[model samples]
Target: MESIYWVLTWACHRRCRHCYEDRFRPYLRADLEAVVAEAERNAPLVLGNLPKRMTYRDPGGPDLPEKMGRVIISGGEALLEAVRERVTYPVIEGLVARYRDTGGVKVVLQTTGDLLTPAIVREVAQRGVWMISVAGIDDFHVGMEGEAKRPPSRRRSRQ
Candidate 1:
């Protein structure tokens, strides 16, 4: 159950008022090889308690040993338009493919519900990733220090 989280990029579409207004930049390129190497070194240590002969599926539909570890790909809104336009989607997909090919780790994705399109969900399913959507209600002011911010319409459920 060891997990590695990689922040592949820094670009986001929606700006949270709390985010630093002056510090916004996208990751031009991610060092995939470095990230993989780090995962390879740390995954086994994290999964020390897991069974020794575990098996898992790779992105290419092959089953491989789960001796290495689990990995998670995340970013500043992984599904944000800026990230998608930059390197978020490709890096995540490539990581999943490599993890599956190696057959030694699990892959998960963290995202905002705003970008969970049907096609994206299908692709995630095919890659055997566990998608976690983070959302919550807060009474704190969005822009002002104490003023409450109104919830966005996109968060409303259609039931």
Candidate 2:
């Protein structure tokens, strides 16, 4: 099976030292229509070889198509506050709704949970999108040149 990864935004709240986007930058707004079209085109090729039709419940509590595609909405932390102008809750919600409405396209939102709010989570969660969440071991981020920088945290260490 093949996968389609789309970097919808490059803006982020945290200036992580390890982030390549922080240095190079990403400016293009993802053309969701084009992405969906591509997925539709590839669906025919993939449908014929599905291991088996997997049945799953949709947002509205209906069965999704046996042959479906997965669309991952990723970025420099999707819910980052710094890039609010480029991406917002409405923008994300609309994109997700459109994709889910198309049927059989599993939507996944990848985030670091920096700016994630309960309302945003509820909205997206009810739409049937899968979440790919991650957290760092510490507040430090390794720089592009291998230097590490740590952020000041209000939370106290256990030790």
Per-model TM values vs. the true structure: 0.49, 0.48
Top-scoring candidate (lDDT): 1
Q: For residue 18, give model 2's deviation from the true position in Å.
A: 1.7
What ranges in model 1 sit over 4 Å off? 17-68, 101-103, 135-159
**lDDT scores of the candidates, listed in order:** 0.50, 0.49
Task: List the RMSD of every prediction in angstroms.
Answer: 10.2, 9.6
Q: For each candidate, how many residue pairs have backbone atoms clashing (under 3 Å)?
A: 3, 0
Ten-residue stretch with the least lDDT total in model 2: 142-151
True lDDT of residue 18, candidate 1: 58
lDDT tens per residue, model 2, 1-159: 224565545444456666655432323346433433343344344434432322244455445434455656666555554343234344444444544444445667776655567876886677566664554334453231222222345434548
Off by over 4 Å in 2: 23-67, 81-103, 135-159
